[model samples]
Target: MWLSRACLRLLIGSDVSEHEEAPLIWLIAGEPSGDLIGARLIEALNQQTGTRFRIAGIGGEAMASAGLKSYFPIADIAVMGLIEVIPKIPRIKRRMRETIAQIREDKPAMVVSIDVPGFCYDVWKGLRGSEIPLIHYVAPTVWAWRPDRAKKFAQELDHLMTLLPFEPPYFERVGLDCAFVGHPVLEGGADKGEGQRFREQYGIPPEDNAICVLPGSRSGELKRLGEVFRQAATTVAEKYPDAVFVFPTVSYLRVQVTELTKNWPGRTVVISSISEKFDAMQACDVAMAASGTVSLELAMARVPHIVAYRMNAFTVQIVKLLHGWNQNFVNLVNILLGREVVPEFIQEKCRGDLIGAYICKLLEDPATCEEQMRSVDSALAMLYPPNGLPSDAAASFVVALLGAQNQTNFDKR
Candidate 1:
């Protein structure tokens, strides 16, 4: 009987007295997107449990605003690309150890690792024998790159929360407990963006052809794909001489993206506000985007678009050697449909002329644009869940875990 009470106390912390030590949940989020998701999760937890938690972790401004006292800067760990990460290896390892040390000292009731799989995996391994329940918020792309990682996660993580509906099966087949919370993208406020407002603000003539280009939000992504996109815009302008190019970037990257566009061939505009970015996307006739979550947003906006991407040459070589071109598509939309609903220009094939050619074709062919938009509708329908919000779904899982522990304590008494 005492054993169960002790276990419950340890699992939930000093929940009886708010003046006593408040319960803590340690979170680790490595990038911007993860930070956004983590912030929402914290809000959900507070709402569902009806108890304020002392949240601490490594995160960006969004999580901090949501009430996390981040122990360190998230940018220190928000690294990507295999070869690009080479120089930051030592720092990453040090931060991993620091994170592990903090988790040990804090002894959080639960440790939630969000999205930065490689760094999170190492931290998970470091806490191998600890009693703290390890919940990983985004499953690794085991279905895409390495199938073996699923078995390792099944053995390590106590629970896996996934964004995609089809993801649970991949992990569950390997004995991992999995839940498909709806994707965060679906929860984006549908009423926020106004395309006509953006066009009016910019004084873009109604007859002018506009193309929105999302190079990517990451600095590294901007560095690799910016020139390619710029070249493509020039090619696009050649076909439609009065074409206006819009580069909607995250605020931090706005100056850099703006500087890059200076060399562009025709009229260009750069916007940083997210709502304004979406508004610009809505206003454009067609978009050429670097493949990422933004591709999903463009689809939801009902825009006909082409997806393009470029990477460090060495990274491209490594990807080719390991995965090859086996996965028929890179754009999330095409991947979801299991076919090329949109044109994909990748690596050496991501030529400006070719990308421009596809954009022109899509603009000229109404049938093709209609067909792709229809696919977008089908993909979105598959993604939306019948129940509550994604954050609420994730919160329900955590709440259930807490409830089970509380019940165990009662049974022992």
Candidate 2:
């Protein structure tokens, strides 16, 4: 909150200097998904003010492409849940220390973190009571589970930028200044892909059942989901011999995903780049994806899809402890819809055959596919902000500290 006037006064005088350089912002993204968000936010920050930003922190290729000089590889903090994170605790702590030290030394204008709350919030907690105004993009899914974290996080955060329209209230109720800046998926260019071009490039027949396969971006995700998805794809191929499977994965994991799916009994294409990923999404008739952000992208693209996820047995138990035995939906589309608009197979029900059956149903039944699209359209409508792109809304929210304050701009957009 102090960053509003005091921090701005430190950089730009009250009259605003024409030649002064913009403030240095420290940004941290701990996964591929977060890397995308950070990259878009960086673009927004620079474009909204027509001033370049001095950036520092950690991210993957997307953020790097957007002019971020990452402190370390994004993979360093990609581990999830109790089972995956236990072995990397030492490395995580080391990285966190390095991050905190770098932030303190830089004395950046603001510290904004994208998702990856485990690492991002930890870094922020270390800087609590300091002058740096903390703004976190993409509110944690306390609404999904762990609702108590909403109040706990309010104590340390200066502001929170949420993607979901319903998320700001969770933190606002606890006394934190929170804003719903819209979902980045709205401006991610998912809906503009050329399906014909993608089909031509891959020589996929227009009549063939093309399925976009997203096994997730993290190493642990690829390891857990690869086998299950392969068997599932094989099942679909057995039923629809002309079906084509499109596997879109992170660049680092592309080769591994291709190798894993090589023997699946269909025409398989693995795509690495984001452009190709969106093109594949357009070309595909349906999708079988890991339970995460891609599910939201598929919904935005209006593709019929079923989501499936399998976590470490120990991690599954930990989630059960935190989430209780009632709510089971992990995919954001289903979670946002307040019902299973998309079929979900998670944990114990995450069998290859079961997922394959759902994929087959989505592929063959036009009614089922059309029905899902209708629901997807309804869900997508709620994600748009009042004006401009979601990132633009986020940009306006972020730069309010640098200029005259506008109370209506906080959440009205």
Candidate 3:
């Protein structure tokens, strides 16, 4: 309701330069992970259009590095969960309006919303019934939770770009032009890290155990899981006095993570850069992380790991009520393989003592660790696009949209 169909039609029909070399691509990414995807997509789009295509929208550090001047900081709308997001609803709505108004003004060739479904879907709805092509990267989890959203996505979006292989059929059957464009974790350089180099740089002894502790990127995640993860890591550290706890965090959270872990018995290293985090993953004997994309990254690094996450109590109950009857896993690796390849401690079970016990088991059992890593290789292999890298495959789909858009009856109208 932010923009009327009448207003959108007027904007789309306005005079646009045919001779302009730089076709504008307004891309929106509402979190760090999506920002990474946005950055790589910018690179791939550059390969297709070079500096001839201008990229702009909301993004974080990574996309900014890829030459995007965002209208606002991604944090303005980066909030997650039902209860946590309620307080920020007004602010997020304001930002969403700002984004819609900008799109109305800029009239970019295509608008691509990456990942954040709530924010992105609203912006797309505002421009609903317009000639402007709407594309969404990372299809919403309709296959797992709300199956009806697949129909909604097909109705609202001009094209759909999915990460999981089995996802395309869900939307494509609904008449949405959905493509399985690979997953970001596959080409993210998670597997290319040099463990020895990381160890040498950090001045850690070769024989010592290095454990990577990732609470999460968002402040909310840190608030929820930080202390629990700290306790779990502490429990593990007690067993191995020489264990080096490596906290791989974003720049803003570096000081907070350091301040929180100052009193720990074992040596601690806080690293902010992505390369350092990946290298730390390689250097790590095991990782205890909040559940999300990091598990896939750990799998890529062949690191033995356990996933833990705690959400608002009310949200937990709602999610449990909403989940499919047979849906058993919170971790992606487990979900894809249709079995528990990695251990997951969620809700009440996401405790320090319980997670620590599992961490201890992984550390003590080398064969178990090897088996989990081997299991993930099959899961990880399925994430790659049949033709090329994830970003490239996504770019090809978008470029095709440009051609199709020109031929559409809506544009001619």
TM-score of each: 0.88, 0.84, 0.85
| Each prediction's whole-model lDDT (CA) | 0.81, 0.81, 0.84
Off by over 4 Å in 1: 1-23, 81-87, 189-191, 312-317, 323-326
Model 2 TM-score relative to the real fold:
0.84
lDDT of 1 by residue, 302-380 (tens): 8899888887789777877886544678777777789888788888888888888888888789999999999988887
Q: Give the TM-score of candidate 3.
A: 0.85
Query: Under the 3 Å rule for N, CA and C atoms, how many clashes does model 2 have?
Result: 0
Query: Sort by lDDT, best first: what order?
Result: 3, 1, 2
| Model 1 whole-model lDDT (C-alpha atoms) | 0.81
What tens-digit string does per-residue lDDT give for candidate 2 at 164-237? 88888889989999988888888787888888899999899888889898878877788888888888988998
Candidate 3 residue lDDT tens string, 1-413: 12233333333332335754445788999988899999999887666543445777889999999999889999999987778889999999999999998998898888999999989989988987666788899998877787888998888898889999989998999999888999999988889989999999999899998888999887888888888987887788889889998888989888878887887658999999866888988998998998999999899999999998988888767765886433688899999999998999998999998988888898899999999988999999899887778998887677656544544634676
- Rank ordering of all candidates by TM-score, starting from the highest: 1, 3, 2
| Model 3, global lDDT | 0.84
RMSD of each: 4.6, 5.0, 6.3
Q: What stretches of model 2 exceed 4 Å from their correct place?
A: 1-14, 17-22, 52-61, 70-91, 312-314, 322-328, 404-413
